[model samples]
Target: MKLYIAEKPSLARAIADALPKPHKKQDGYIEVAGGDIVSWCIGHLLEQAEPDSYHDRYKKWNAADLPIVPETWQLKAKTQTRKQLTILKKLIKQADELVNAGDPDREGQLLVDEVIDHAKPTKVKKQNAKRLLVSDLNVGAVKKSLSNLKPNSEFIPLSVSALARARADWLYGMNLTRAYTLAGQKVGFKGVLSVGRVQTPILGLVVRRDLEILNFVPHAFYEVLAHLNPNLDQDINSQTSETFTAKWQPSGACEPYMDDEGRVLHKGLAQNVVSRINDQVGTVLSVDKKQKKQNSPLPYNLSSLQIDAAKAFGMAAKQVLDTCQNLYERHKLITYPRSDNRYLPKDHHKEASQVLAAIKNNQGQEASKVDGANTRLKSKCWNDKKVEAHHGIIPTVKKLQSASLTKDEKCIYQLISRHYLAQFYPEYIYNETQVEIEIAKGKFKTKAKQEVNLGFKVLMGKSELDSEEKLPALIKGQKLLCFKGELIEKQTQPPAHFTDATLLAAMTGIARFVKDPEIKKVLKETDGLGTEATRAGIIELLFKRGFLKRQGKQILATESGIALIQVLPEQVSKPDLTAVWESSLSSIAQKELSYQHFMQPLLQQLSDIIELSKTCDSSAFKSLPEQKPNKKFRRKRKTYKKAS
Candidate 1:
C-alpha cells in the first residue's frame, strides 16, 4: 500500500475526497485515490532528544553545570505526538511508497524531518520514499502535488535551517534559563528567571524607553502661531477671485538682527511674531495649485495590521497577536497571520476582485460600506517578487464563524476585512490648493483640498481620509484677502511617552548612536530590535520583568528597569548586537553560515557578561530594582487569622 502524509487532518480529508470512493477513514488517517492510503501528522511527531533522556546527571538544573552543550543532539519521540509516530511508523514500514505531504514551510520541513529521523523508515525500506509540498492544501492543489513529488533531498537545506534555528534557540534557552535561574537562586531569589536571547534584547528596549520616560527632563520652549481666513478658489478651494489667508508663523522672539551677542540669524525671528500680527496689513503674493491623489495602502502583514489595530482600537500588542492567531488558526478566515510579507502572488490579482465582492455581500455584515472604485489594485507594494515564505494576510472567503468573538477581536477582523477589500479598489483621488497672504510684510498661508474619487474613502473614517487630503488648485500669485484672524501661542513640549503601539514601532525600527554610516544603514534594513514575531512578546516581557509600567496609555520605566542597563555589565541595550545576531541568522537561512558560528560568539559574550557583572559596582543599583515587581503582587494584603 502507498502511504500519504498530510500536514493536517482537514487537508488529508480534502485529499481523500478527491480520490476514489470509500473516503471515510478511521481517526486521523484517511485514504486517497488510485490505491493511495493517506494520513496526517498533527504538526510535529518528534523533537530533539531531551537532556534527561540522554544522561541521568543532566536531568536536574544546577548552576555548577553551566552550558548544556551535548556531544551531538539527537531526535526523540515527542511525548504528546508519540501516538502519531506509532501509526506513521507502522504504515511506512509496510508501504510500497511514502509520500511526504507536509506544509511548504520551514516548520513543515522540520515536521517531516523529525518523522524521518526517529521512525527510521528508510533504514528498513528505502525505495519509493519521496516528499511533496503543497502551497495550498485544497483538493486540487493536493492532487497536483501528488503528481509532482519532489525528492526529500530538495528540502534538506530548509530542514537544516529549521534544525539550526531550533537547536540555537534550545541551546540558548536551556543554558541561559538554567544559568540565570541558578544565578538568581545564588543571589537569594528562588523564582525561575527566564531569559531568551531574543526576549532579553527586546526587554532591553522597553526598559530603555521606560528609563527615558522616568529620567526625562522636559525642556520648555515657545512657538508662535498666526491665523488666516479660508480660501474659496480653484477646484479644491474654488477657482474664485476671493483669496484665503496664509498660515501664521513664528516671528522675532529673540533679538531681531541681534547686537554684539550675534544670536539671531533672521531679524524676523527675534521680534514677537504675534505682537507684529496686529501691526500686520496684508496683500496677496502667490497661490499654488496641484492635483493630487492618495494611492491605496498596501495589504498588511502581521506587524502592520497589529500596529493599525492597536492604534485604532487601543488593543495591546500581545492581544493583537492573539486575535490574529484566531483569525488564522481557529477561525481560518485569513491566511497565516504570523507572516511578514505585505505582497501577494501574481496569480492572486484576478482572484482579488472576488474577495472584494464577497466582503460587500458579507454574510454577517451590516452593509456594503465601500462603493467607490471597482477597479483593480495594482501597486509596487503588492508585487509578488517582494514576497517570500508567505504572501500577505488575506481573507479566504470562509465567512468567519466561531462560537463567539470578543468585541475587540470583532473590530480587528472588521479592520482586516475592510483593508482587504480596499486593497482591490482603485486609488483615492483628490485635489490640493494653497493660498499665500502678505500682512504688512509678513506672510501667512491657508489650504483648500477636496476629494475627487471617494474610492477607498467609503470604507475609511474621517481620521483616515483627512490624513490623505492636501491643498489643490490655488495658482502662484493668485490674490487672496483675509478679513478675520487670530493669534495663538503654544509652548513646545517634551517628546511624548512611548505607547505600546509606538514602542513596538520604535523597537522594530530602532536606531542607535552609531559611528559608522554603513552599520547604521544595515540596522535600518533589519528590524531595529527584533523580528515582528518577537517584538510583541518582548514588550510583554518588559512589563512582566517590571522594566516598564503603564499608567493608562503612558509607559514609564521602573527604578530597577532604569538601573538594569545603566548599571549593566555590558552595553546590552545598544541595538548593534541585534543587528549582528540577525546578520548571522540570515546567513544560516541562506545556507552560507552555520549555527555553531552564531552560537560560539554568543556563548563567549554571555560568559564575559557574567564575569564582568561580578566585578561591577552595583552599589547604586543595590537599593533600586532591576525592574518593578508585577503589580498583582502589590495588592493590599489583609491579614486573616485562623478562626479561634
Candidate 2:
C-alpha cells in the first residue's frame, strides 16, 4: 500500500482530496481507492529530549553540570501526540511506498523526516520515499505537486541543518540557562534567568536601546530657509509672481559651525546666513528635472505584512501571524502565510484572472478598484528565479466565504488581496524637479515632485502619496529675488522607543545594526534574527518570560531583563554570533557545509560561555525584584439553596 504522511491534519485532507476518489476517513488515517492511505502529524509529533532525559542527576539545576552536551542526540514523543505517533508507526510498517509531504521549509522538513526515522521503516522504503512540496492548499495546486514528486533523500541536508540547529540551541540554552540561573540565585535573585541563542540577543537589543534613550541629552540646532520669487526678466517684480521656499545648503567654509551630520551647530552662524541672504537678488544656478516611475510593492512576506499591519491597525506581530494562519488554514482564502519570499512564480501570472475575480467577489466596497486593473500587465514581482521554498502570500483563486472570517481575518485578507491586485496595475509616474540657487555666495536648494499618474497609488490609499511642494518653472542662469530669510531653531531628539512595526523591521534588516562588514553582509543575505515561522513566537516568548513589556504601543525591557543583559557576556548579548550561525546553517541547507562543521565550533563556544557565566559579576541582578511563584486558580463548588 502507498502511504502519505502530511505535516498537519488540514494538509492531510487537502492531499486526500487531490488523490484518487472514494476516500474513507479513519480515526488517524485516511484510506483511498487503490490501497493508498494518508496520515498526518499534529505539527511536530516529537521534540528534542530535555537534559534530564540523558541522566537523572542532571534534572536538578547545578553549576557543576554546566556545559551539558549529549554524546548522541535523542528524540522523545510529546505526551499529547503519542497516539498519532503510534498510528503513524503502524501505518509506516504496512506501506510498500511512502511520501514525505511536509511544508516547504527547514522545520517542516525536519519534523516529518524525524518521525519516519523514529518509525524504523524498511531500508528500501525509507530510501525511496518521495517528497511533495506544496505551498497552496487548493486542489489544483496540490494536484500539480502530486505530478512532480522528487526523491526525499535529496533534502537530507536540509533536514540535517535543522537537526544541527535544534541540537545547537539545546546545548547553548540548557547550559547557559542553568549556569546563569545558578549565578542569579547566588545574588539573591530567584527568577529563572533563561538564555537563548536568539532570544538573549533580542533582549540585549531592547536593553541597550532603553539605556540609550535614558542617557540621551537634547540640544538645540539652527536652520535657515530662503523664500524666493522668480524674476523672469531680471526685474524685481514680475507679472508672474510665484514664490518657493528653499533650505540653506551650508558651503565648505561653514564646516567649523556644523555638526558631523551637517546640522548647523551655532545660532550665530545661521543668523549670519539669514542676514546676508534676506531680500537679496539671487541667480538660479541649476535646475534638474527627471521623470521617474515607481513600480507597485511586491506581495506580502510574513515580516513585511506584520510590519504593515502594526503600522496601519496597531496589531501585534503575533496577532497578525495568528490571523494569517486562520485565513490560510481554516478559511483557505489565501496561500501560505509563513513565506519569506516576496516574489511569485512566473506561472502564477496565468491565474491572475481567477484571483482577481475572487478578490472582486470577496471585497465589498473596494470592488470597483479591481475593474481598473489590467490583467495583461505584469509587474516585477513575477520572477520565477526569485521564488524561494514558498511563494509570496496571496489570495487563492477560491472565492472568499465572508461570513466565516473574523474582523482581524477580514483586515489581513484584504491586505493580501490588495497587494496581489496591485501587481496588475500600472507603475506610478512622476516628475522630480530640483533647483539650486546662489544667494550672497551661499547655496540654497529645493526639490519638488509632481505626480504624472496616480497609477497603483490609487489602491494604496493616501499614505503612499508624495506631499512635497511642487516647484515653479525655472531655468539655469535665470534671475530670482529672495523675498526674505527665516531662522528656525530645532532640538535634536533621541531615537524613539521600539514599536511593533519598527522592531519587526529591525529584526528583518538586522544588518543595519551590525558594525562588522562581513557579518553585516551575511545577515543581509540570510533571514535576520529568526525564520519567518518563528520570529513572532520568539517575540511573544520574551513577553511571557517577563523580559519584555509593553508601554502603550512601545516595547521595553523590564528591570530583570536589563539586569540579565548587563550580567551576561558581551558575545551572548549581541547579534553577531547568531548572524554567523545563520549563515552557516544556510550553507548546510545548500550542502556547502557539513553539520559537524557548524556544531563543532558551537560546542566549544558553548563551553567557553558556560565557564564565563559561572564567574561573571552578579551585582546587576541584586536589585531585581523577587520572583513570584505561579498561582493556580481553583473553581469553587456551589451549595444547594433548597434547604433555605
The candidate that wins on lDDT is 2
Query: Whole-model Cα lDDT per candidate?
Result: 0.61, 0.86
Count of clashes in candidate 1: 33
lDDT of 2 by residue, 1-644 (tens): 98999999999999999999899989998999997999999999998887768987766666777788889888999889999999999999999988999988888899999999999998999999999998888999899999999899999988998998888888888788778877877767765677889889888888999999999998899999998888534443556567789999988888898888899889999999999998888999999999999999999999999999999899999999999888877777889899989999999999998888988887722878998889899999999999867899999988865467788988898899889989988999988899999999999999988888888888977734356875788999988878889999999988889988998898888898899998898888988887788889888888877889999999999988898899999899898998789889889999999998998899889889888887899988887875432211001001001101
Mind giving the per-residue lDDT tens digits that candidate 1 earns over 1-644?
87778767755665575567866576657755456788888877766665666676665665455566778777777678778788888877768877677665667767766675566676534434678765443444356556777777666666776776677666666665555444443334433334555666655665665555557764323333343323423242545534333455434544454333333334234235556664344555676667887766777777788788878888888898888766555555566666667777776666665555555554323354544435454665567678765677776545433336667667777777777667656667766666666665665666677777776666675634465324434445543334444443333344577787777776666655344677777776664566666668767877787666788977766665555556553345566665666656656766778767777787777666555544454444445433322332122111001100
Error of 2 at 213 (Å): 0.9
Where does candidate 2 clash, by residue pair? none
Q: How well does each candidate superpose onto the true structure, as a TM-score?
A: 0.77, 0.95
Cα distance off (Å), candidate 1, residue 281: 3.7
Looking at candidate 1, what is the lDDT of residue 551?
85
Ten-residue segment with the worst summed lDDT in candidate 2? 632-641
Task: Report the Cα lDDT for residue 583, model 2.
Answer: 82
